[model samples]
Target: MKNQKAVLVILLSNVFIAFLGIGLIIPVMPSFMNIMHLSGATMGYLVAMFAVAQLVMSPFAGRWVDRFGRKKIIILGLFLFGVSELIFGLGESVPVLYLSRILGGFSAAFIMPGVTAYVADITSLKDRPKAMGYVSAAISTGFIIGPGIGGFIGEYGVRLPFFFAAGIAFAACILSAFILKEPLSKEKLAELANNQAQSNFFYDLKKSLRPLYFIAFLIVFVLAFGLSAYETVFSLFSDHKFGFTPKDIAGIITISSIFGVIFQLFLFGKLIDLLGEKKLIQLCLIVGAVSAFLSAVISGYFAVLAVTCFVFLAFDLLRPALTTFLSKAAGEEQGFVAGMNSTYTSLGNIVGPAIGGILFDVNIHYPYLFSGVVIIVGLLITVIWKEKQFSQSLAK
Candidate 1:
């Protein structure tokens, strides 16, 4: 038990540092565009490129995690993450930025699934939700801290945050290399290897494509799609619409992340127990859709802030609830399932920003409006889903 707790802390800390690097660049994106003389579509592509790399790499990364062990992959990913951030910080050309983003995506593909699967390996089924909550809170807390710190540093220079994030990621890499231990035992690894020898990747993937798993993937895609669209154009929108600076954008994201952290830490586990994952997911989807739509039309900074807080809160609750649902259903394929989860998320990130960027060219509000409508569709799909049907399908 003590060993498990120790592993969890190390995993959580590594994840926090990794995500903080990602978030640190968010507020300063406008500056990046200006410096690079990029268009909206170009910037969108830059953001989407990271997910594109992740989408392509995640399935394979998942298999590797299960085969090789989590600790090695995590350390390698963190080191590469630091390198990517450093490249972005130092690069002067658009091509270099693209290269950096692609590397970042690959790093995320390894890190996200490894961390999630590691958590599942260390935790019991009954305690999984709570453990997942802490992981989610750790991620949210990084975003909470990243933007505030990045915004402050960004005042000096836009590239400064990237350098700072690079240093942090490298520090995490060193810490994880020394402290993080593999969760699986030698006997368990031998068993899994023997099982793998008998079966194959295609066969395992086919088994994992159960109805509930499909629903979980769809939910992740919808959630990521909506959020990415909103986030991709947010700084630009605020700047154009309200004359807000990077500092203002950072402040808003910081506030929203605080709400997300609070929900993930204090309310998410209890809510999962109370309403159940299905019910809570449905509720959050509805709230996310409404809040996103309201954010588009709302006037006043405070009103927008309030609406966005609800959006963040809904998203925060939905992530762990859905992750818990999927992890419970993953059976022995925790790494593969987590990889697929990252794939779906990457797919959403890819499509959302591409479409959102094009729409932002037409009108800034269009992206948010489109996000709300798409989420509404996701809500409808959730409503029509039947758990009994999923269970029967899986039983086969």
Candidate 2:
């Protein structure tokens, strides 16, 4: 138990750092765009490329996590993540930047599922809500801090933050390779490996489409889609609209994320038990849809900040609630479900950014307005989403 807890702590740190690396790019995006002389359409493609790569890698990553063991996969993810950041920092051409995003996407595929499955392997179903709450909190904390630091670092040089992120991630990768032990024993690992050894990719996708899990997965996709659409050009939007600098963009995101962390750390687990994942997800979608629309029309800095807060908070809570629901229902197939989760998320991310980016170039507010409509669709779907198996599967 002690060992598992310790391992969970390290896993939490890994997630935090990975997300921090992601957030670090946010504040520097406008500068990077200017530096590269890129258009909004190109930026959209760059962001979409990440999801495109992740969508391709998720099935293989999931199977590998189940087969090769979590420790090995995460170490590889960390190393790749470092290299991706390095390339992004140094690259002068658009194609080179695309390559970096693709590599980053692959690293994310490895890390997210491996870490999620490892947690599931160690925690009881009853304890999973608390466990996932902590994991979600770490992710939120990174969102809170990373941009703030990145904005500050960008004042020095836009590329400096990426290099800094790369160095830290490489160090983390080295530490993980040496210290992180595989939680699953060899026999368990072998069983997991064989379970996926000969499985066809299309068959696995078909399996995930079972009525039991399909609607929940759809909601996951919509959640990612709406949020990514809203966020892909958030810094650019703020810069164009209010003449906000990187620091200003970072401040709003960082402050709003702190609220999310507070909720995740203190309120999330209780809310899961109180509202159940279904009601909470519904409530959050409503908030997200409304706030997303308001974001398009908001007139002032504080107003944008306020609306952004609600948007971020809704998403922050929504993901964990949905994850808790799915974890309860996944039974012995945690790795498979985790992969599917990532796959769905990547799918949403892929389409959202491509459209959102084009819309951003056409009009600054179009993406946010589009995001509201997309989330409204997700909210409406919840009315018909039904899952009877989840109630009986877990006592909690």
Candidate 3:
């Protein structure tokens, strides 16, 4: 295979398995928590721990990717992920599950940024969005398959899903060891090394704390807040509102994943190509806001499922487009820009489930309403930013 195609395959496969590992447990988490007598706050903490570890380790992981190689970092991530899954499957207690989540977070931290950087390294600026769209498709495809299978297995036992995750991770490790390869030119590595040696981490951290960072951070917060609520509590809502079970919820999610993949593969790339990233981002945010609001109002499981599919489609499209936009915004500083974006995303993941859990503690509807409001706010900001950028470009 050509190097670029091979890289794409490897990265796409990496996200597929990684997310499959995560999704394998989704259908069982709430029930398992109930069986273990865990509270909403505890669930929130367990989920947040995973994101927090990713937040802490992402920068270092990105640096390691640049220093050593993408192949090495990805292999390391797979190992951690496999180990975490194996430990979690032992099913001791809530505390053990939390510890496993922390371990998985570090694994995700190592793998995700490295894979993204590898994609950026391989694809030209023009094709990057499309390449990223492919990655999104892979992830959703995994979600479609993983949760569908997991939901059935979870009916028998929750621990079985985690065991499945461990097996997948182990297989992924073997596949990656044989298949993944580095593509960075020697000149690129030397330049990266010299820059890293001369760069001050404090300076970079301070810079990432600026207004742009805040804007991007809030955007991710809005996106993740909506998503986490929908993912974590929507099944419960469907059960209450329409008498759906875990299998039914899994079916809805599987259908949603199909929409997600279709939009990401077919629509997202073309929309970005035609409208450009800034305008496409505005469109996605607006669509997300509308879909999420509608999802909250819908009562029937099928109706809710249909509307929620649109929400996932918009979100899946926007993520890669937004990542490319943020990369361009940073200009010549891909590492810092990517690292900052990943950090903010991790922050959102940390905040998202906790906030959702709190609202779920009140009324499930509260989380959806809050998420819709945030999505609208995010859309407005992106629209304004797009107009400003357009004016600047026209003047130029």
Candidate 4:
């Protein structure tokens, strides 16, 4: 394969492994909590705690990825992820499981930004949306296979899937050490260093403080928020709202993952190019808000599944475009931009479920309604933020 293609494969490999770990846990989380005798609120706490850790570390990790290098951070993240998986696999109780997720969240703080930063390093501006689409596709593929494997293994034992997940991370770490090279070289390093000396970190930092990045930041936050909110309470919703079994919930997610894969791989690239990133984002948020609201009203498993799948389709379509737009707006500071965005996303994760839990306490449908409102805010932001105008300025 060519150099760019090779880079693409390695980055995608990294993303697939990273998400596999997540997929391994997700299918079993509700069941696992039950076996350990945890309450619904405690389960929500478990999910929020992880996001809290990620929010705390994201900015620092992102800055380091920019200043030091993507290679080291990627390696470091993989190692931590491997360790976290092992901890999860060995855990005999809820506290141990909580501890493991904390470690996993920290690992993600490095891994996610590191992977995207590396992709940004290698891909050209023109090809970036497509490259990011590939990354999203890799995530979808991982979710497809990982959950299937996890759901199968979950029948035997939940812990088994975690062990398998750790092994995948270890294999990815080995590949990273051997197969991937620093895409940015010595000349780029010198340029970075010279530029770093003259560049005002504070001034540049101040620029990212504008309303545009803030709005973009909020968009990601709401995306994460809406998703996490639903995910935290979904199993309960499946049981109480529709009288659906856990297996049925898994099937719903599986079907949605199929749609997500198709959207990301087949439609995402074209949508971004055709509509531009800003328009696509606006469209996605509007569709997502409607879907979430509709999902809350639906009672049958099939109706719920179809609505959720449609929502995920829009989401998968939006992701690459959003990432590309955010990266472009970050100016020369990819790491900082990625980090701040990730942090806001983490904050959404932190708040979304907490709010969902509260709403779930009152009424199951309320969480979805609240989620729709959050996405509405995201939609408004996308409209107001002029991504094309921003990119043209960068070109000048």
lDDT of 3 by residue, 228-255 (tens): 6556666656665676777887888889
Candidate 1 per-residue lDDT, tens place, 133-226, comes to: 9988888888888888888889899999999999999999999888887888878767766666665557655755667587778889988898
What lDDT is obtained when candidate 1 is compared to the true structure? 0.86
* RMSD of each candidate relative to the true structure: 1.8, 1.4, 2.6, 2.5
Better of 1 and 2 by lDDT: 2
| Clashing pairs counted in every model | 0, 0, 0, 0
The list of candidate 2 runs beyond 4 A from truth reads 387-396
Per-residue CA lDDT of model 4 for 1-396, tens digit only, reads 388898789889898888877776667776776677776677777778889988888877877777667887888889888888899889888788789878888888898888888888887887788888888888877776776778788888867888888988988898898888876776765665465556454554475567656666767887998878877887777766776654676677778878988878777778877987777888888888999889788877778889988787777777777788787666567777777777887899998887887788788788889888888878876676676655564463
TM-score of each: 0.95, 0.97, 0.91, 0.92
Best by lDDT: 2
> What shift in Å separates residue 293 of candidate 2 from its native position after superposition?
0.3
RMSD of 4: 2.5
lDDT order of candidates, best first? 2, 1, 4, 3
Give the per-residue lDDT digits (tens) of candidate 2, residues 74-151.
898898899999999999998899999999999988998988888888899888988888888888888888999899
Runs off by more than 4 Å, candidate 4: 190-206, 386-396
Model 4: worst 10 consecutive residues (lDDT sum): 196-205
Q: How much lDDT does each candidate structure score?
A: 0.86, 0.89, 0.76, 0.79
Distance from true location, Cα of 30 in model 3, Å: 3.1
Worst 10 residues of 2 by lDDT: 387-396
